[model samples]
Target: MKLANVQQPIRLGAMTLPNRIIMGSMHVGLEKLPNGVERLADFYAERASGGAGLIVTGGAAVLPEGGMGEVYCNVFLDEHIEQLRIITEKVHQQKGKIALQLFHAGRYAYKEVTGLDPVAPSPLQAPINRTQPRELDEAGIERTIAAFASGAVRAQKAGFDAVEIMGSEGYLINQFLSPVTNQRQDEWGGDFGRRTRFGVEVAKRVREAVGRDFPVLFRMSGLDLIPDSTTIEETLQFARMLEEAGVDALNIGIGWHESKVPTISMMVPRGAYVWVAQQVKEAVHIPVIASNRINDIRHAEEILQAGRCDLVSLARPFLADPQIVAKSVQGRFDEVNTCIACNQACLDHIFDGKVASCLVNPMVGREVEWALAQATVRKKVAVVGAGPAGLEAARVLAERGHEVVLFEKQERIGGQLNYARQVPGKAEFNETLRYYQTQLVKLGVEVRLGTEASADELVREGFAEVVIATGVVPRRPEIAGQEMPHVVMYNEVFEHKVKVASKVVIVGAGGIACDLSHLLVHDEVISPEAAEYLLAYRILDAKALHKLQTGKRKVFMLRRGKHVGTGLGKTTRWATLAYLKQNGVEMLTEIEYKRIAEEGVYITRNGEEQVIPADTVIIAAGATPNDALYHALAGRIPVHLIGGAKEAGELDAKRAILEGAQVGRAI
Candidate 1:
């Protein structure tokens, strides 16, 4: 657990980092804020002080047309340099090395935000962008290469220690490299040599502009994960070309933005794409950095020890806990809040037009606003729930110098989260529980498990204030014969309180119902060890391995609404639905539930009534607030209601934890 390999100092070009762990780039939407410059500076400064060996900033557009919406920073603009310089100065003050990523969105640029036509090597339209792009002409290509060089020069002026050319993830450089996006017969496309020219020329120009001794990293797509795209051999060859073009190191990026592959999802195993980086490292003399799902020091150390890559880059993990390195170095692994890759708060938020934040660590993007200052007066408080909200509130309150006690009626903590961890591919929820457990104990919060505190009991126990986070309960929908012998709730299914049938029908197509359907179908859960063993020995390919983890049974999910995954985040909804679809789970929408019968459930679809045959039926409609205790303690003592106890519209852990932290700061 010493993480000796991760702690080893490594050199990227002329820069010697303190350790091998690199904080990768993440576009947090902070650059577009009114006080963006100052806010961004504080955000990076915190991570720098938290002991990041080196930090690669969010992508900055090298040119105006290449901008990824208005949310991204344009380093090519001279007006932005002074603001960016503040960030570099603050990070330098923390004694941490920082790199600016020069980016061009190509066809990925948003016409709605930038009000300009996107330009790529070919006029092919991006699936996500949904707009036809103008193919870059000969003159435009030269201008782009020059823009990359100028971006690097501007980064140096901004005082960045290094520059990372964003060549991966379906960006401009990647668009030119892949045949899927580049079909032109010009000098920059149609063949492998032409496809690779743009990236190499950009790298050579950036190196020339920055001069020798200035660190330059190229983020190359190790695996496009898209069919008929760049082959693995071509990817490695491109890496060699980049090194020859004077890139100090190669940072391997897995999957394109258009790829359906689950690269950074919870289902993706830790270090899943390390082999791709290993291939690039073998092909190049320069150092290589592995990204995608490398979430912790242990996994990073393991990869480094195995000589897979020279260094590892973690983006979302840094957002989950800025002090991931510092805490691990101090041997406080449990204290490190691990990124669950839920995408609920971070990526999903950005997609929802909100700034990026973490689900577990709510204070990520709000470093300036939500500072955890010490309390002026210490008081004893009682948190009457051990779910995410209560756990976070208890941890923060104790950290703010309060004597806190966390109560739970159940034997264990993590209220609804306990059931969430039981769902297929959601095992990372257990890590969130582990972190809260560690933090609560570390901050001296007394936990009373298997005991529910009443109003009089809390008042009599000398508690100055009470936080009611009693959580939620499964809402039973009004359906005839729903209480039949074969009928059970979703929680019962998770707790194994009832036997599940093979041909099952699930009522309500919310997040829980989708999860239950996923659980029931995927009976053959492949362990990570078994998967790695199968792949390492070439016993099975990735496609074959995925088949083994899919449905072993039949499931049908019916909802009254037209949309499936109604409450799920945008980042994960499509993928989850796709998984269910692959498992042969039938998701029916715009249906009316009549009743549950012995044979099956009767439903009306398109004004036609029919019975869906099933041996078992489950109601995962939704949940309602469990606020009986909150009502009882309302006027008797000072009380604050939070989480499901306050509102059960959606079981949102992001809002729950944020509320907990806010209340913790308030008290």
Candidate 2:
């Protein structure tokens, strides 16, 4: 794999990249305290050991006003040099290259902390901030440029092998380059050429500050993913200018933070930004790095093999398994825990003010010192069902040096997860299945596909313990449309067996429901149809979609509750709401499902009856415990049920994995 070539040594300008894979910079507010630095040191050291060629530390503020935040970050002052050095030295010990992203949040920074006003090409604060920012004067602009140069020099002196300018994600440099944010009449705004000047100046100054041969990585947006901003063609021109300025590489980024279309900003597909990389690479002489929901090797390979980008940057995958490269090399990829992108684990944890961790790999931040397994002791374990829960359970147990067996009723693996993966742009979910399958094989967890491991068989076989992970069933909503031919459940739609009408209406507002609304009505970010399906959701400004429902589309999301539970992360939920509204999606909340007709759905909102127009009806109400198998064995034998079978996927994966581990620990 060209990207995987990072696992071995390669020349990266002045720095010899110990490998090809660069753990791209991700700011989780990790640059503040000694402990944060220590946590980061452990984080990088583990990846370095795991075979990362380079580790780019998260954004470090050049000036207090331009800082990403006040949390974890290395302040480029003389006082903090030693602390930053500690991180660089740790990576060096493993022959890894570590670069620090020199950043100035510019307008994104907090004015109170900077002692100076947050400055931008215009007097605009990011819409969310609602803060009235002071516009930058010519002198102030010069100072800001100097600040960036100083920050780059400080990073190089702090022992970083390279310095990457954080110009992507609608950051300062991007803010200057974008018409959406840079509404100034001066040379720094208006036309694309003028708007790009700040970024070009910043790059030139940064290179001069760091010296000609000292490898400087420029992070740039491939597409703003924002309305009324730079287009793909302009982005290509910027990439050329970036290279002409002596930039070593461009870490291509897409989208702006705090936008109505941020789903396109943060998610949609793994390596979704590869196209931006390709565009830039085609016009530039330097390397182009791509990222965006990228967590699978096969997808990464496609991007490289297709010559889309020079490198694939993985944030969550590396978080899930810093040792993913090493394990994959040994063909032990499945043994590496897979991230579900539930974002519940890492992103949610970060916003909630905790060090980042993977929902699948809880060991992400603790890699400097902790291990989940005990080498000397061992046990025999059985994991029933091969879905996310059961698969996670079996992998962890077997890795503890336990003798394990995983049973599945289907010829294929994955339980409910298989259905979930059938949705468009969700194929990456197969990564989890692949990881588990590989791990089970490598760990020698005897797999019994197309066979059910009945408790009776386990008992008769003299097995010490039995684990049951039967999963769940989707409950049909109790309504007049319950048996309607045009009505269908998300399960049926996802399974691809159910024939959807040319026009369809999806009910419910949880994760799956919203996902279906996005999918059935639009193309997934990864699909070729994405360009045509992109729809601007007026309800939730952040909820941008690509699917276009055949025929004139009308989806009625019926509700019967006081509050709609998004079941998405807080940020994503708000973003979704804003998007759905913006896209002209009909959401009838606090309404009861009364009936379904050929025309649409009949509903009652706040106790008042309302009839909504629809062509076909679908339900995302929820799931029921799929436990017929468990019920038969309950009285006959002791049976433990996990996952949806336990409580509709209600925070029970942890419970299931722990139960499997504890049961293994005891055995």
Candidate 3:
């Protein structure tokens, strides 16, 4: 209950920390300029004011080739010191300490971004990177070591409290640490000691540059969680060597985020890596910090109580709400904007060289310039539709001291968000629901359930402003025999999540249809593992129900679009593709669906007719926006559309909520 209160301030070498919470370094890849670094003053100053005891900024490029995404990354140069100094001064003024995380991406570098071929410990390419990296030789390795030291010296000069060496996440250091990637037989390979040489040398040189009293925290991965990667035992031994090599602390992160399950990269169950932190904490006398999917403070408290690690380092969660620390300290944990971990804005946007943005918190990286105010005159505001946009608008207007009323046709507050939570690995979506519910109630918005608003009601209430968040409705396609009992809309499949028949065909390549395909293939009812699989699966299986189902599934994907897929983030889009491939989903991309008959689906492939057998056809192609209210009231009253009603986005609650909030504040 008293996690931070019980903490005695720990020392980070010469600098002292206020508490055990370390804002760990995570690259949203949101640097705005060719410089590829976030502005030090705006970002660090925001975190400092948000009560970050020690702010560890995102990883900065140490060299030109390692520059990722866009500009604003603090490149280690003399000219940047004045800017960094101004940032450090702002943080210090707010009574916060700061650190710089330095790194060279190496094989993690991309040909598209870097222009030059990537360089790795060996020729073995990192899984996510399409770029085949050139192997680093002795000279290249030495240059990298010097680059890290130079970054540390720059941090020291820029008035950073400390410098963190990022030797984890399968970067250059981990590549060398693993036999899977480190094929070199020379001085830097063949064994753990040799593999750790580059990292240890970097730490030593950085420590030497920053001096003995300066802190050097090594952010590392205890286990790569990939085949032929370093195991926990080997990583523990490596941790000891780092402590011996003069690292003041170890920030333990897990799994090569790029190769393994990307949802694990963002949305694994909370505390997925606490055990890794616990193991390292037991192995090292120095303070230990645990990261990776650590958004829940209750989970953080439990980990600390069990002595898993000395500190909780939040990445996505901090970005979701910078005021987490102050709110948690004030017992207003409910007010904290919880990260839904959708990765829609952060990772996906980064691929486009855009600044980091949170699904739930629209003001995340752009906070310094974004704000809103209450109404100058407290007028009545009516929000039609109790979905994300409606809730956000009502909450904003009410908070600004206006009378607000919210109406939903459903019995609950959440709109499409209600169904989004039904998907596997998407239970975290409820965080947005909790956020809006708390804010709406506290802000004095009158919420009415099961109330469908007619245009006349608005005029009766004399509302000065009306926001219609009328959402989308699933449109029944004009396909012949659609009324056949077997043909179902994408929403029905997702809502019921029941598996029928051994072989099925999903007729839509978009995200919703894709989600249904995954559920049917992976769930037990459809692709049971003896078998066990996706969602409502075990409900039908009465016997031979095993504990875990690792078996893959077989299904079919029918797409009519010329490009196959559109409007999805790359990593997520890739993930769905990989799953379909891994699960043996036969995809008929760019195929036209002629009709669904008794036995199978008739289609056209490359102007030729083809038939695919299926026991069930799941329709996932499109939805109709349920905007009768908006249409009827459009010119007479003010109305704004959000989510699918506005456009076909990935049906993310965070985006909906933020859009709603944005509109609400504007109103």
Candidate 4:
């Protein structure tokens, strides 16, 4: 697809962006001080130099009470201007414009972190981050408005080209806009105008603070997907009101923490929310920026060419490849590292109170540390296994001017990813593999397919360094009757190496077990080719695909732990569990496995023995490090263990890829 419109310049208020692409704000939690200055500047500067037209820093707390649970920038004080100035200067040096997203966490703010009870439009608590928020009185509402205005002035003084008000994501302004959270009968909550007054007032106050010449962007939810929240029509009316309130531009955001709709997950199709931005763009004269799940240049171009929005905002895509825009402009889109929207590293890290990183790009939050330098001494390196870890190690070493050879026992690359791509809703996993394949070919790394080099052979080959990333092997628990013909491993089912019956019992409730249950219970076959075909044509939607289960088989997932899917990422766990329940997949947690029988499986739950009838038994009981080769080569040659071979605790792509990059750079 031609990206003529996507590469065109756009004007937003008083600012003329070099291109139509904007780096959407995402919390990285990289601040080192309350005044919000330090390595965070380095992070933004890298993206700026990489060719983003405009960079929007993550939300900075507008008030002391609005402090997020994690470390975030604070723009409420005068001292913050100096530190913020450092960031603006760095971006300016690259001729890139920047904006600060001013936010108030509202009820989402943790009392433990802020040392203050959260305040909302009403006393209603948020569904996700449950907190008993105190109702904001009239004076408190006025104070919040003033705080937003003050934050804008601070941003202006810091030399930002524009400032964006965080009126989306169920924050303070959004709390007042949504009827579900705003139950008060006061001036701020009774009618539509009353409910939207908080956002309108903040926009007006910010415009007054920054003056008409300075740009002011307001981020608004085009559709509050949560129940009892604002509708699309209401959102359009709100957009018009915001424009009248002096908002220079509108950024359309979708869903919330409490919304049932999938916003940023891999299950959601690309450009799914472009229609939301289209409605808002038609409702108001101000330019609109569309965000969420726009991954590749083709998708971004589709949204722009369709006139859905004037500009496109990408968050995770920038994390995956900071040079995406530059690469696209230079007609090198194939070289771009496309974001798979796994949310494993970026969102999961933020929730864990750690700095956000990327699964594919290890240099995301650690740009300074992971920056590549020309190696003074190049050596011959051998990377065993072709998993994510091994591919990353080989790619980095080759980029550093080292002679590298990647060996895989299988005929093709992508060790575990090959199996993962067969599961339902996991077709996006192939993008990671595709990226590695492209990089290996581009770097001229010698690839040995179907060649399993033994320790002795590697030693004789005289490789200066060896990276053993053999990944993991399924763990077979010692249980009576496990050797029955009906028993099979999860991978065996995917590989078509085993026969199964209508009734199945899967041991373990981790990610693998859940995925297997989804695969077994669904009647429709979803091959990688079929999934890609459907996605390309937009023939199927996530909602329809989720409810397409015919329940041809009865599957039981048993877990010894108290909870199921503990290994699953927080963003996708709820939806997975809901899918299993809707499809009649029985989940039994806190069960002790007694034995596997040809006819069924026996287990003990709550100190009571029970027999679950099953025609076949599948083992999803985790995995173990395939470290025998590493041990065999240890000390014989310079052997380095990475990925699952180093430690088989959880199937974390983030840890695997990061470890690979670290080892490659160090070597």
Candidate 5:
């Protein structure tokens, strides 16, 4: 808990950091909001005050064709320098060092957004962007190298303490490094040395523009995570080349945007890719930074102490809790709101071209508007149901100097989240519960567990306002033989109230069903120790390793819709479904449910009647809102409805917490 390793100061060129945790770059979609610059400044300022040693900003395009749209900051513009200065000044005021990331999307850039054909090292079409980019000609390549140097100068002019060349994550520079994208016989491609020239030249030009004294970092892809990409030896060679080019440090990024691997998701184990950084660290003389899914201070300290890398970079963790480093250093690690990496609000929002926020912390983008202020009038408030909604409402109200009492019928908090934590890979949900438990106590919230408040009692208590966050109940599906002993709800399986057999047939293919299938199939959790031993000993290859990870079970999910895992986040849905498929979970869409018997589930798929044999049947057909308390208390004292009591279409925790905060502030 002392965090000595992370607390140790590290130097990069002329700059010295107070700690090893860097707030990694994240495109928060805050640059395009109304009063965007000020909001962006406030966003970074809060994180800086919390205690990040260095903050690397989101990508700032060096060329007009390199940008995504109006959302991106074009450093070539004169106006952008003044706006960027505001961000640098705010972070400096908090005693934090900030770095600007010079970026070019290349083939990753969308023609729809930039209104121009994307350019790349070759004419290879990018799978993710679905765009066939125009190959950069000789003149275009010269201009690009010059543009990177100009961007670095602009960043220094804007008062940034450092400048990081964005060369990773399948960007313009990465495209030139990988053989998968680069196939030209010219000087820019056809060999490892030729391919690496573009990135090395960019780094050299940037260093020359900013001088040797100014800090310069290059974010390089340690593992492209794609087939026929850069090998480990090639990556190490690139790192050495970058050091020779006067780059101060190396930030190792894993995978690419077009990679099939799930780099940053809830399913990925914490600190999963630090080994990649360790390889780069061993190859380079300058400091190396490990990134991707390194969310906690303990993980960061361990990575540094293990000599994996010189520093750790955390992007989503800061979004989840701006004060993550501050709280951890104070020995309140349990109170830190850990990033679950659900991608529901952060990456998904970016992909959809909307302002990004956090599922756990909704006030991320709305910093100025949602800042907690003392309430004008303090009064007794009752928030029923100790789920995410009630817990958040109680915490916010108490923080605003209001007396709050929270009620829960169950003996514990986290209503549906309790079931969520039971699923493999979602154990991080327990952290959310732990954070609320600590905050509720610190804020002096009166939590009444095992005591469900009735509408009559709420009126009798003379509560100024009653929040009905009663949550939801499972909606039983209409099927024949529904009362069979083998049939049970999703929560029953999660709670171990009903035993799950080998062959399981689940009714519904929503997020819950997908998660249930995953839970049932994975009989035993794969510990990181076991995974490392298996790989380190060379006992199993990649294919065999994947087999061992997914346990032996037969799961069949039936749905009337075409797509499985509907309503899931864009960044997560595909990976979840792919993992399920790899685990042998059969998903049948556009199937009409016939009946559930002792034998199995009979369904009509493509007008063919067939019975899916199963030992257990699970009903994960979503839920209906539990709003009886709200109706009972209507017009009886001041009453309000939130969370599942208000709506239960998809059990959206993001909306629930947001509504709870808004309602708490309203009172």
Candidate 6:
């Protein structure tokens, strides 16, 4: 697990990167009015200062008709040059190289966002976005090529070291490359050569605009993973054409927006798509950047040592820990916060039309606001609980030269995280827990496990400040047969404190309910250690391993709301729903919980009452704040309530961690 190769330098065209790490482009709407110029500049500069060798910015629309959303940067106008120059200048100040990713959304672009009709190779609509796009004629085709060339010229004028053309992920170039989207009989469609002509022309035009000295990277799909999409053999030919057309490097991207295959989720094993980069590297002499599910430096190093690719590109990992490279270089790998691939804040926030943030690192998008300052007066602080909130508060306070003592009632540290990791496809939570444990030890914070601190004890101990992050307690809704022997809470089942029969009915449909249903029905249960070993060794694909765990029982998930799993993150909701459907798990929504009995549970749906057979009943309605200690010591001490102790309406680790950090810095 030596990472010697990852620390080595690499060359792409005329630019010699300081290392092999590249910050891949990911859309995070940071641009605002007035001071947006400075905000965007500071955003990339932070990552540059953290020791990234090279950075590729998010998509910059080359044409108004090709814009994905209103929040994306626009390279189509001349006024954008000065605004973009700020980012390039700041990145250069940190001795970091940057590339502008020129994008054309094609059919995926929204007309509502750009106030122009979307255009593609043909009039066909994309499967994922489902927006009908106007077909490009001869004149429109020429305009698109010219627009891309103009974008490259602008990037060069802004002092960017390189420009990467977006040809992957079912965009305009991908539309022409796929027969399913481009059903035209014209020269830009039909056979492989004709289908690839659009991408090759754009590359040649961009190269001509920026000249031979400037680095030109092209991102292509190694595997489209969609119906009627271009095959790897066809993509390889397209790669050759791109190389011949003056593409200095190739970045291997897998799947598409509409692809059914799971590429980036936690269920996908780490480095699952490294083989894609290996195939492309074999076909081209140019440097190849491997992407998708690469979270650790050791994994990146392994890929490089095996000659799978020349460089490793990571997006979410940098969001989780911007100093990942610096920490690894200093031999502090255990302190690095690893991305769990939850997509709760990053992807889901972007989809919700908000600035992207991170679950583990709350200071992701708001780097300026969350910047740590030295505490003027150090005080003795007590953090009650060892959940995400308490851990973060203790870490920040200890880093600020405060004497912090973290108390956990459980024998092991991680509060609800211990139960969360037991669910399928959630072993990554352990990495977050490990990071906090390592940081606490490194910062010399006193950790007291299996110890509960009461209000009287805290007052007697004479602590300067007390942070009540006591977490939450499950709500036991009042029902007729709720006290029956068959009734149990979701946490009871996960902790193995209660036993259940094969047939189970779960009340309420949130993240907890969904996970419990999956756990109950799934046939094979793999230990976290075994799963991690398989993932590290690449012994079995996670998807395949998951398929082996066939459903063994009939489970029903009932929700009183209109939608099921409404509390789930937007990015992962689809996959979870699909998994439940595929396993024959019945999801009943907009129902009234009448009562519970030993043989079954009674529910009213659409004004009709019915009894659903169930041998076991699990309640996952919601949780309430455990604020007894805080209420008891309201005026006695300087008490501060945070995390679930403040609000526990939903399972929100994002708010819990962010609030903890905020309180820590304020104190």
What are the Cα lDDT values of the candidates? 0.90, 0.71, 0.75, 0.87, 0.91, 0.88
Model 4, position 488, has a per-residue lDDT of 91
The superposed Cα distance between candidate 4 and the true structure at residue 577, in angstroms, equals: 1.4
TM-score for each prediction?
A: 0.97, 0.80, 0.89, 0.95, 0.97, 0.95
Q: Is candidate 1 or candidate 6 better by lDDT?
A: 1
Off by over 4 Å in 6: 68-71, 127-131, 525-548
lDDT of 3 by residue, 1-667 (tens): 4655324477877777877777878666545543323354666677778777778877777876765633546555777677567767878888888888897787888778667788888898777788888998789888888988888888888888898888888887878888888988899998888988988898888888888899999988877778878878889999999998898999986767566556343336777668888889999899999887877666677777778888888877778888787777677878888877767777777766666777777777565545566578888878887776677777777877889888887789887777767766668868778988899889888888988889988877788877878677876666777877777777666656555666677777777766666666665433433343433465544333432342344568877776444655665777666766766677788777788897878988989997788778777776776777777777777667765566545555556667777776776
Q: Write the per-residue lDDT of candidate 6 for residues 512-568, one digit (tens) a residue.
A: 898887777777666668877887898878886676567668899998888888778
Q: Tell me how candidate 4 scores on lDDT.
A: 0.87
Clashes of each: 0, 42, 23, 0, 0, 0
Question: In model 1, what are the clashing residue pairs, if there are any?
Answer: none
lDDT of 4 by residue, 1-667 (tens): 5678888888877788888888999998778434335578878888898778888889988898887744567898999888789989888887889999999989888887888889998888777665799998888899999999999999999999999999898888998999888998988998888999889999999999998889999999888788878988899999999999998889998888778878898878778888899999999998999998888877788788888889899998999999888888788777888898888888988887767888889798677767898788989999999988999999999999999999999999998878777776778888888888989999999999999989999998999989999999899988899888888998798778988789999988888888888888777666557767776788876665545535579999998888888778888888889988888999999888888876798999999999999999999898999999998987888889999999885666778899999999999
Measured over all alpha carbons after superposition, the RMSD of each candidate to the real structure, in angstroms, is: 1.9, 5.9, 4.3, 3.0, 1.7, 3.0
Off by over 4 Å in 3: 4-8, 33-40, 111-117, 123-127, 130-137, 263-267, 493-504, 521-555, 562-567, 577-586, 605-616, 649-655
Q: Model 4, stretches more than 4 Å misplaced?
A: 33-36, 69-71, 525-551
Off-target runs (Cα >4 Å) in candidate 5 are: 525-550
> Over all chains combined, what TM-score does candidate 6 have?
0.95
TM for candidate 5 is: 0.97
On the 0 to 100 scale, the lDDT of residue 653 in model 3 is 52
lDDT, model 1? 0.90
Winner on TM-score (1 vs 6): 1
